[model samples]
Structure formats: structure tokens, C-alpha cells
Target: MRQNPERRTALTDAAIEVLAEQGARGLTFRAVDQRAGVPTGTASNYFPNRDALLTQAGRRVFERLDPGPEAVGEALALPRTRASVDRLMHEMVDRITAFPSGHLAMLELRLESTRRPELRAVLTEQIRANLQENIDFHLASGLPGDAETVVHLYLALSWLIVERLTLPDLFDADRTADLITTLVARLIP
Candidate 1:
């Protein structure tokens, strides 16, 4: 049976919202059906199975986050200051927190993919793309390799810090950026 693009889009959007608000572990066919204002039968008609639905939903999220070369250029173009870097890190954290379930779901997908070849393949591709984008951004910024390493470590730490802090209050964006800038500068000549 053919699917209506509009309906499929609606379902996908609905799935994202639920995943963001409720975490992947809490996602249910019935909840998505309600969120989409469609019947569970309709969702089943479109996705057919749990893994199928999750893969599609995860794919959509990953696609949106692809951060093409243009995005890398933008990141590189930003001033290399602690405030700027901190703001960037905070914004990323906000996004992850806002889409709690999607993040959790993706983590689950990552773990499951460890034993599932197909999923592992998908994850590998995504990780590769993401790594490339980061490398391009770092190189374009003209930062030294050691400084870039610090920035990478800082970024990971920032994510963990943001996860532990309350929304909007975890860290002052300007201050964080300033801190990153100072740290990076110290690493520089």
C-alpha cells in the first residue's frame, strides 16, 4: 500500500516530539498514535514494527543533525573566544536535553547496534561523518592540534556538565565561552 507523504511526515514529526519529551524508553506505539492524531493501526501501517519505527525516527534525527560543511564553516568563522566556544557547547547541550528521549533512544540504538551488524554499520557511518565535520571545523579555525585536542576534551566534558545541570542555569553561556577561550589560548603559543 502506498503511503501519503503528508501522513508519513506527520507521523515522523509526532515521533520526534514524543521522543524529545518522553525519552525513547517511554515511547510506545499508542503514544505516537495519539501524538499524531492517527490510529495505532495507521502507525503500524506505516512503520510495521518497533525496530522499523525506531530506525526511521533515528534516521530523521541523524539527518537533521548532519551539520553539512556550511555549518562547519560557520563554526570555524566564529571568534575563538571562551564565550563563543562556551555558547556553542551550551547550545548543543540544550538541544540534547530538549530531545531527551531521542538522545536516549540513540544511545540504546548504539548499544544494540554493537550486536546488530546493520545498526552498527549505520552508526559507523554517522560517527564518521560527524568526526569529519569536527575535523574540518577545527582545521578551518586555525587552532593548533594540541589546542584542538583540548577543545575536543572540553566539548565532551561540557556535554557531561550540561547533562548534570538544570536547563538554562547549568552554566552561563558567556562565562563558559570565556573559560573555553582562556583554556584554548593557554594551549596555544
Candidate 2:
């Protein structure tokens, strides 16, 4: 039996939302069906298992950040003024901080991939894609040498963003800007 492509996509999206809200630990076929307003068998027919559902959700997460470098590059190519860079950095921080579930799912996948060879490859590809996007920005800015370092800085800051939200103190947007700016400055050619 065939499923509607549009509905399958919708189900995957609903699964991501549920995973984000409950973490991987709480994801269930029933919950996804409820979220999608489809029958449980509908989700089971496509996913068949937790891994399949999660893997598809991971791909969709990356899809949402499409044309990654070009998108980030347009923002970077703006006037090289202080205010412009500041605005860019603030926007980047907001966008990254807004998707807690995506971040959480990535973290879980990273850990799980340690024992699952197939998952490790998928995660590796994601890392490469992310690195390439960062490298693109660095290259455009004439800072190719610092590409890997900048990527590391971003990973660290992202972890901090996640952990900070868990604490009583909310994320300080200003501090995040200062950190990224200082890092990017060091990466400048």
C-alpha cells in the first residue's frame, strides 16, 4: 500500500515536534499519530520503528536550513559596519536558540551514533554539511584558515545555549553576540 507523500511529510514533521517536546525518550507512534491526526497504523506503516522515524526527522531538520551557506552568506555580505555585524550576530543567535528540539535531537543522535555504525555515518554527513556551511562563510570573509576553529566555537556556544536555558538564568543575547563576534574577529584574515 502507498501513502500520500504530503501526509508522510506532515507525519515526519509532527514526529519532530513531539521528539523536540518530549525528547527521544518520550517519542511514541501513538503520539505522532495523535499529532498528525492520522491513525497509528499510518505512522507505523511508514516508520515501522523508532530509528526510521528519527532518521527521517533528522534529515528534515537539515532540510529546513537549506542552501545553508548561501543563506548565511547573504547576511554576512551586508555592509561591513559594526552595527551590521552586530545585527547579523544577534539574528544568528536568535535563530539558533529558538530551535531547542532540533538541537536536542542532534545531541541524542550524536550520542546514539557512537554505538550504531549506520547512524554514525549519517551524523558524520551532517557534521560535514555544517562544517562546509561555516567554511563557506569563512572563505567569503577570507578566513579559510580559521574555518575549523570557528566551527568548534559554534559547537561550544550552541551547547552553552542549551544548558543555559535549563538553568534559572535565561540566555543573555548580548553575551552571546560578544562571544561570537570575538570568535569571528579572530577568524578574520
**On residues 89-144, what C-alpha lDDT tens digit does candidate 2 reach at each position?**
45665665576666666666666678778778877888788768766765576433
Residue 152 accuracy (lDDT) in model 2: 64
User: Lowest summed lDDT over 10 consecutive residues: which window, candidate 1?
Assistant: 157-166
- Report the Cα RMSD per candidate: 4.4, 3.2
- Model 1, CA-based lDDT: 0.63
lDDT per residue for candidate 1 within 64-129, as digits (tens), equals: 555567766676777775545555555555555555555655665666577767767777787667
Segments in model 1 whose C-alpha atoms lie over 4 Å from true places: 17-28, 66-76, 80-87, 144-151, 154-162, 165-189
> CA lDDT of 102 in candidate 1?
57
Which candidate comes out best when scored by TM-score? 2
Candidate 1 Cα RMSD (Å): 4.4
Best by lDDT: 2
lDDT, residue 82, candidate 2: 45
